[model samples]
Structures are given as C-alpha cells and as structure tokens.
Target: MIQLWTPEITTLLTRFFKANHLPYGQDFPGHIPTGRFSNGKLNPDFVASFLGIKQTVPTSLDPNLSNDAFNGLVFASAGSGYDELTTILTGAIPVPKQLGQFKSYIAKLSRIFGNNEAQNIIEKSLAIISAGTNDFGFNYYLLPMRIQQFDINGFQDFLLKALHDFVKELYKRGCRKIVIAGLPPMGCVPILVRKDSSRPSIEHVWRTRMLMPVLQWKARFTETEEGCCGSGLLEASFLCNPETPVCETPSDFMFWDKLSSKRAAYKAMSHLLVNQILPKLTLE
Candidate 1:
C-alpha cells in the first residue's frame, strides 16, 4: 500500500509540539525518525512495519528528493484539515492540495512504470488518512469563527461531510483501498487533561459521540493523568529537549507528549489495526 504524510507530519514537527532537532534516521530499522510528536515511532511507522513495507515514508513536499511512488510518499502535514479554511488559518497543506500532489505523483509513476503498471499500483494501494483531530483541537474549539458558525453537532456534521468528499475524491483517483482513522479520546490526551480536564470530557460533544471505541482502549492504560516525557504538562516536541528529564520507566506511561501516545501505546494500537482492522479492510 502507498502511504502519504501530509499536514499531519508538518503539524507534528513544526506546530503541534515542535521536535525540530530530532534527526531523520532509521534508528529502528523499519522506523525512520522524522520529528514525529511521539516518544519514538508514530502509529504509521508501526503499521508500515507490521505490513512489511519500507519503514520510511518520504514527505512529498521535499523539493530535492525524487518522487518514488514505489516506496510511498507522505502527503500529510501537521495543522492540515479536511477544509481549506483550516489550512489557511493554520498554514498547513489542505487535504485537497495533498490529493493534488498525489495526482502529480501518480503521473510521475505512470511516466516511470507505464500507465497500466501505475494504475495497477494505485488500485491495489491502501491509503490511510489520519486527520480531523486538528480540525477540532486547532480550529473549531480553539478558533472563534468555526465555533461561531456552527454548534458542536453541526460542526461535526460539517467535518464528516468534508471527510466524505475527501474519500470520494480518493476513489475517483483509482484508490480502492482506504482506511480513515477516527479521533482518539481527547479527554485522555495529556495536553487537554492538563489544560482543562473538564472541557475535553464535558464540553467536547464531538468526543462524546465518537469516543466509545477509544474509551474502551482507555481501560488498558494506567498512566492517564500525565505524559511519559519530561513534566508531561506542557513539554512536547522541541520543548522536550535534552535538558528536560524523561520518565525512568516509559512503559508505565500511556502518552509520550502533550498530545501523542507512547511507543507502548502505539504498539497496542498497531496490534489492534493488524489483528482487528486489517482483516476487515482486506475482506472488503
């Protein structure tokens, strides 16, 4: 399956938590460090490794790198969302723009491998989309405009419709296999918990509607109150530098940062995706 890391990666590295100094290397064979907002490998890295694909999914935004569709490309950027306004506000690449880049990549693949081969690859490829978290965390709740325009349920509907359109566009581009990730329980996230625990639990109606599955997962974690890295209150990305002390035992903690899951948590999630989620997707 071909992979893409659009605004998700950018947001994770640049804006979300800021892990600028982290080196990009295959420190874990199949896991390449690209300044992800996590203690170690992100969910995508684990998923790709589990699927026996190449570890590093290169960002398509890089100007120097050759467009190699065989290895897969990451179109996701941090702070990006399903909507254009979200992209504009956050300065992250929009989902539609990422799709546009995908189209270009496909064309490049066609040139290299011929149309039939490129089409075959595209049809067989699995596209994993992990977005919408920023839409809520960065835009709807954080910004005044979206909240003013629509109430909780209404905004949820709007975002869902946008997601529908994004999937439709991917289908149109000959992508048959697609997996759209749902939002995690925002209440349990370290940043939200530290900021205002009551808000994520009570005010976030969107979380209440879609958090059952995540809540079930929550029962597995013991360190729900804080992150594993540093103080866990505000430390994240670059803020979690060398000077900052880390937990002696990370396995005891569920999160690695203000908004990211630890390696152990990702491992559990990867297991779920492989055992439970993949089987169903493969069946389809």
Candidate 2:
C-alpha cells in the first residue's frame, strides 16, 4: 500500500494593501501586475519562494485571471480589515469576502481537478492570515465607531474573536494548516512614529492579545524616522510615483510608504519565517 502524505498547501494573506499589486511595483509587469502595498516583494512573496512554490501568487480579484492553485493566490486588499464595516468604509475587500473568493477558487479547482484532488490540495494547503493592524490603524485610531463602542482593550478582544472565527472557518473548509501572523511593531512604523510621539504604544497589546510569537526586524532597519519614498507621511501606491523623491539607500529605510515596509524589512521577515516558522508547519 502506498502511504499518502499531506498535500502541498495554499496560504492566504488577509488585510488591506498587504496583497495589493496596484500600479505594479517591481518585477511584476503589466502581464502579471499585482496590487501589493510595498515598493517590492512583501513577506508572502518570500514565504512562497522559501516554500519552493512559485514566487508570484496571483491576486484572486483580477477578473481576467484563471485558477492557478499550484502557484497559490493572494486574497488580501489594502485598507481591508477583519471587520466588515472596516472594508466598507475603506473600499477594500473584507476578510469574509476574501474567504468567499477562496471558496469560489476552490469550486473552480474542483471543476478542473475533480472533487477528491481539490479536497486533498485544500487539506494540505497552508492558509496564512495577516490582519488586525488595519483594525487599529485605520479604524480604532483614525475612525470613531469602534472607539465609541469599546476601549482599546475591548476592541482588541473584538478583533481577536474575529480572527478566531476566521481561522475556525478555514479549518471547517478543510484547511488543516493555518498560520496567523501577529501584528508588526506598529508603533515603530515610520509614519506613526513621525506623526505622533504621544500615541500610546500598542505593540505590547497586540503581542499579548494574539498570543502568537512575533517576528522581530527592528534591529535590521536604520532609517526608522521616515519612509524611503517621498515624504513618507501618507504617500503610497499611485501617490508614490516615479517622480516622488526616494532615498539614496532604500535598504536602510524601514518602510517604503506610510504603511508598508521596504523590501529589506520584508526580506528579513521572510528569512525569519523560513527558518523559524516554516519548519513547524511541516512543508514539503
């Protein structure tokens, strides 16, 4: 009897702009443009490469695209959050909607590969869910609804529960291996650090609430004061154009835009994931 092992996995990155490929940053041309928030490769890009899978995971939102489960897919949106209201307010795809897209992708895969093969792939695929920061950055801090309803701790609990449900749903859909990324050092993000020194530090709060081990990349960044692109205040995507003044040494900068980290930072993060995180996931 031939012993079957767990199938190779597909992972999802949740949250806004985390997977946006708009305006096509680098490497990805018009033929395979993405809406990623960063100036170059995000953490997921490196994670995919480290897993020995195809590096460019196509965004599921593209209308002209077809299912390519072997290469993986990115369902995240910039400005999106775990909360439905958050996506509605920011005009980004909500977490639930991203999952819905995954469901649709699975259906298409079933049509092409048959039910059993699709189910095996789904069972083996890794689901990477990155969220929460936007709920704090865009909603609780910038908006008023969540603040009016709950204090910082209360809101954190709400988001944690939402995350819990998201993972639970993925498990229900046959995704056995799920990786939920904890929030980065949001306080250290150039835009926030430059804008508000008085802002209370929530890094500890996020770490504590999530109960997941955090990846540290602070030591790798020398330019923590501002982003490499333009003023680094709020510039991103189209706002960060070719005409925008960039730093002479982008590798030194922690961020490429107001919200997204530079390639160097993400590269460090990818190494951490490959060395520390991926080993436990039992990837082939």
Candidate 3:
C-alpha cells in the first residue's frame, strides 16, 4: 500500500521486495512478481476466468500494460480500507479515491471507445470490493484515537456508512453488478487478536452460511494456525523480506503472509463460484 513511484516491476524487485515483496507473486508462472498480497493469482483473476471475461486480472495503474477495461481491472491497494485514516496510516489509496479513479477510467474509455460503448461496459461490468478489515486492523486496533472516538458498534456503523456511500457512488457510475466482500472473523485473524482462540465475532446462527469457506479450508490445508511466510504471525509488506524463511510447502499453509494465502484464495473461489455467487450472478 506504499505510494509507488512507478507501476513498472523489475526482476530485482521480485527477488527482493522493492523489486516487490519476496513472495507477492512467487507462485505465478516463472515467479514473476506483481503488486498484490497473494503469491499468485487473486480472487478477481479466478472470477474473471469463470465469467469467461479473461484469464488474469491486471492493475489499472500499470503504465506499461495494455488490456481491455471491459473485461476487468484492479484499483485495489493493499492495506487500504473504507476509513480515510486507515489509508493515511499505510499511504494506501482511499476507497473514495479508488471510486474516483473508476469514474476517470470511464471518462477515458468514453474518449477511446465512444460514450455508448463506455456506458455499456460499466453497466455490464462486475465491480468487486473487499474492505472493512483494514479499518479495524490498521486504524481502530493499532491506534488509541479510534478507541476514544468510537465504540465497537459505532465504528462498525461508521464503516457501514462509508461502505454505503461508496456503493452509491458506484451505482452513480453505472455499476449494476457489484460484490462487496465483508470482514473476516476479526477476533481470530493473526494480526487482530493473537489469543489461543474462541468463538469469533459472527453470531452462531449465521456462522455456517458465512464461514463455509473457512470450514472448507480446515480440511484443505495442513496448517491453518499460521502463515507460510516467516513467523506467519506479524510479518507483512517489507517485514516479509528475502531473509525471512518461507515454508517449504506453502500450499499446506492457510496464510502466505499476515493477510492472504494463494491456495486458500483458490479454495474459496471454488466454493463461491459453484455454490455461492455464480448461480445468482448473470455475467453475460
């Protein structure tokens, strides 16, 4: 989520983190690094392929890249959240600004592909957003100011309002198909609460429906207690460096760094596409 001076990635950057983080794209073909948390393909890439739009999702900000925006593009920044302060802490692109970028993208497309075609693209395109976690992880939990300003419920409401506004903005820009991923069980995440483990924040009734992917993952991987990178507890971004010892069998681990695991992403997508989202969605 660090403000990048350039969208270009070098081989040296891939090996080291400044070449990009050591394992960000370590699982990709030929180990080519990308500016993402996952070691290989992300959830959007899987969604793109399933929808028959494309094979891989590309970042919209890459200066040297060429791709049809109609298929899909990523405006997501790591560590970014709906909360403005969360982005300020990590120098990430704020959700509001990401929406602004989407608007600008439509304008640019209008110039290149004509107004009707551009509008058609936006109306039909699926907009996927994953937020809320950083608001709690980067802002609320890390700083005392959040504690003073908002109670847990108040902060949750604040984030919900921010999310609501963001979706309305997306609707204004012609996005009829949108999927917003909610926060994970905050009480159990490695970065959030490091206690032995208890029931997570989600209520017992909805737990089965909401956490089916998590249940699926318990059997899918050998290691779920920690990440595949280094200590698997606190390391992320630059802290997860080349010197850090990565697990030999990353596929066996549920997490790659502090936040995500590539294999887990694949696992979740399978459940989502087959049982959760695909049948309900009309991508055509």
Error of 1 at 65 (Å): 4.8
**lDDT for each residue of candidate 1 in 115-185, tens digit (9 for 90 to 100):** 99988888988888888887888788888899999999999999999989888988988898788887766
TM-score of 2: 0.81
**In candidate 2, what are the lDDT values of residues 60-121, reduced to their tens digit?**
65555654445577776666778777764566767888788778877877898899988888
Q: Model 3, residue 8: displacement in angstroms?
A: 16
True-structure Cα RMSD, model 2: 6.5
Best by lDDT: 1
Task: Pick the winner on TM-score between candidates 2 and 3.
Answer: 3
Error of 1 at 138 (Å): 0.7
**Each prediction's whole-model lDDT (CA):** 0.68, 0.64, 0.65
TM per prediction: 0.82, 0.81, 0.83
- Model 1, poorest ten-residue lDDT window? 20-29
Leading candidate by TM-score: 3
Error of 2 at 131 (Å): 0.2
**lDDT of each residue in 40-104, candidate 3, tens digit only:** 66666666666666766666666665656546677766666788888666666677887776787
